[model samples]
Target chain A: MKSNKTNMKYDIIFFAVALIILVFLFLAYFFMTRSNGYICEIKKDNKIYGEYKMDKDHEIDIKENGKLVNAVVIKDHEVYMKEADCPDKLCEKMGKISRVGETIVCLPNKIVITIKGDKGSDSLDSMTK
Target chain B: MGVKSTKNIGITSLFLALALVLSYIETLLPVFIPIPGLKIGLPNLAIIIVLYLYDFKTASLINVMRIFIAGFMFGSAFSIVYSLSGAFLSMIIMTIMKKTKKFSIVTVSSAGGIFHNLGQIIMAAIVMENYYIFTYFPVLFVGGIITGIVIGIIARELLPRLRKIIGFEIKGSE
Candidate 1:
């Protein structure tokens, strides 16, 4: 009975610690990733496909081998996947992104759209440096 | 010895079937959260229960087989890779925690849940070759915690009943 009580105490401590750390990480990640971004970088299969300005409202149809795989739209300082042919269409449901480090990924098509600020202004790499 | 081993195998197979059914049921449910990779991780209940009831080897064997069969049945090739990494990492953490014998079932299970999401996020980062995927980590982490606790509570309730029926001696951490 005594050991059981001690174990219960340990469990509560572990739970509190885990909860605090994860909540801290969640907040830290949120603030760190939240930043005004002007440039949108699109990549396919880890290769740069195009870069677009978020200030401009336009539509881009991403093509692979003469077939449309995804459509990206930029409007009102935000970007989103307007349409995607991917089986899951998760990218289309990712909503819109206007902050640096935000991304919409289409796994089946291997496409990633990331919001980035001007070079060296708010780059995550520079933040680490 | 033969009879004991057979019983072990039989029980392990039953757990595997339960895990697979849970996986299938999860797929059939509508996606409540728009986040692409976030899941309630229902099948983890079976895995956690098995880990506590049997040894690590038995739990992992059931886990791996369930992942393969369920992945092929309901998910894509990429899902297998993602789940394999997640399950492998979670099992390692759960086994370590269980070995310590200081934490409760809920703690061990929740730890397993958090690491499972982390492992999947890591795999997604590698596959997408984009670090931005880590942004989803926070939401998934919280989701893992909630689901883990729920599964843990259920397992805690079911374990004693299961032991009563199976008549196997439970070792360490009552």
Candidate 2:
């Protein structure tokens, strides 16, 4: 007798989908590769937060609550509140950014540094659109 | 069989207890290895075991108990939405796997893991009123594969023995 068909043929589809997942993850990591970034100049109360090199791995210094604070970030220069003493350092753990979606927000310090495309469009559009 | 039968009730309760314990234990553990948006979901063992041992409906009910009770106990009142979303999709996967009974535990559990994560992310999207949350899918899928294989192996080993106990015991004993 001819070989009878058994089991679903769709398992092949699952394997293919898994392969796609692996490839997509690689591409995501590649797109987020480490690199030097633009130096963002921060100013507060007309006082300088100093110029910082936005490289793959670095942090910039800013004084908060009468003390110096360091805000580190990943490539693409997404600023986050790495260390601050404003009664709550919640923003410190917000972590680095490689994606183009949002900003590292430190409401206590009134600081909001967002990442954007080359054209520097609005953060909302680059993320939502 | 009488509901009072000790063997019948004992076995079901044991698995239920196992599920609950696993749920609580998972929450207590420190969670590292961020995959953007996915739960390690180590508690799936009880469900998978019950699916193979007692019955699908039974396993499903236990899953619900685990989610709801765990949610209540954690006092993470805000996270109810996320828990329900993940539970809903994961249950759907489990139901399909129980019915088909033709796939390896690894494949089925991986799908279940993926759906569970998808459900939570969908809920997060709804709460945030944004679709950008979908961007986390890739990382979540990768996490699913890893967690699923680990959990699948646990269930794979536990299920056969559990089934053997149920097979020789009174009805509903598993």
- How does each model score on lDDT? 0.85, 0.61
lDDT of 1 by residue, B3-85 (tens): 16656667788899999999999988777666767787889999998888777887888889999999899888878888999
Calculate candidate 2's fnat. Answer: 0.08
Candidate 2, residues B3-83: lDDT per residue as tens digits?
356775776677668877887777676546433345678768777766666666676677777777776875254355577
Residue range with the least summed lDDT across 10 consecutive positions in model 2 chain B: B30-39
lDDT per residue for candidate 1 within A18-119, as digits (tens), equals 889888987778776777998999999989999998889989999989999899999999999999987667788889989988888887787889898888
User: Any runs in candidate 1 off by more than 4 Å, and if so which?
Assistant: A127-129, B1-4, B168-174
The C-alpha RMSD of each candidate to the native structure, in angstroms, is 3.7, 7.5
Please estimate how well model 1 matches the true structure, expressed as its whole-model Cα lDDT.
Answer: 0.85
Candidate with best TM-score: 1
lDDT for A96 (candidate 1) = 91
* lDDT (tens digit, per residue) of candidate 2 on A39-78: 4444443344454555555556666675776554444545
